[model samples]
Target: MKGLIVRIAAAVVLGAAIVTGSPGVGMAADATALIRAAFDNWRANSSESTVTMTIHRPGWERHLTMKGWTQGHDKALARFTAPAKDAGNATLKLGKTTLIFNPKLNQVIKLPASMLAQSWMGSDFSYNDLSKAEDILTEYSHKIIGTGHAGGHTVYSIEALPKPGAPVVWGKQQVKVRDDGVLLQETFFDQDMRVVRQMTTDKVGRIGGRDYPVVVTMRPAAKKGQWTRLDTTAARFNVPIPAYVFTRSNLQNPRN
Candidate 1:
């Protein structure tokens, strides 16, 4: 569950990819185009990102910093940079396998594919959700649920329910998309129709001729309990990432 939650927090930095020039594009059309654009862009670029999080739970408050690089849709490598306990720990994915590097143990453990369905720290996202980028429209059927104002921004509300037998983790998901197709917020519901997690993206900007968000925050849906908040401060796209960065063996055997 811890891994799932952590990845969900990581996803808050990733989930939004919009269509560039789809004026009058309905929710469905925009969603389809959004996924295609994200998939195409990720396929052509390698990038680096930095993430910070404040985890709050009963009588506990912790902060975490993570840095990593991503290549295409299937490769990524990230390591914790802060909080003495988690610092130096790493998660690396190369195609289908995910390896976790533990500095204290000086060892790497390969996680089973089936474990992807498990939650990250009892948080909203699943481990499988973190292993690769998702095509929201392609992976789930979206229905224009309604319109709403979220975080003081106008948004088109949509609900994505997975198709029968789909490799989905959430029972239902709500997304708030800006007029331009950027997803500004998302709420995930459990099988009991209760919200499990929520994410909000703020401070949108253009980097390298493409529109993107600079900060994204995620928290738990429940109000009474303490939840974690993750904020992304920097995201760089189309940069050079070492070819071996995302490999499991590379993480296990770091170069001097």
Candidate 2:
């Protein structure tokens, strides 16, 4: 659970930054401020929501459904209810230790010090990107390269390069931002500019009184039939999430 939450946070934070950060290329100085404002608005209230994930590939597919709650940015709970093998599994991703509940074993396992670069649920998103927010500005310096179009929308093309001695993933990244500073798509590259993976957002809407993209998708750039889509439904903001909602035991004994 800890690992999953970290990946979820990383994805959400970066996506939110991209969505709220774009303003005008001519007003580069204001981009940072605009992004901050957007973030604050989105985070104005804590949230709880259910996520239904669909994974598609050439010969295989999966449906992962979970209902969980969250408070602010650091805590989350998810209960898996699909793909029989993972059913009745509950995970609480809080801070560092990811507590996983296995009904088959009737015990909770703590996953710590695990490899951070592996895939989550056999999908494209890495384990590292699932938890903590990647400090792009802190770990890598970015410069506006140019403007481009992604998903048929005009976007600002920004190139990011890692700082010296920073152990970052990918050699570089290209971000496509809308005129208002929302990130429409992000492309990760190797040293030679060959795209490694890509993340995109669709179906933007106001959820829980904040602007949110209802659907997020990630996939390898050259993969023809591999992709993961996360669809969020009926999200509400600033709701009182019970303290026990994030506990490991609750996931194992959800009916309690």
Best by TM-score, which number? 1
> Compared with the true structure, what per-residue lDDT tens digits does model 1 show for residues 1-256?
0111122235322222233444455344455454344333322256566767666668777777777566766676766778888778776766667677889999998889777555443433454444334635556887666676644544677777788788766788776666555556667788787887776655566643455444455566665566556555666667787777766667867541
Assess every candidate by TM-score.
0.76, 0.73
Specify the poorest-scoring 10-residue window by lDDT in model 1. Answer: 1-10
Could you say which candidate leads in lDDT?
1
**Model 2 agreement with the true structure over 151-227: per-residue lDDT tens digits:** 55556666678788887666886665555444455677887879887767766666665556556677787888898
Alpha-carbon error at 132 in model 2, in Å?
6.1
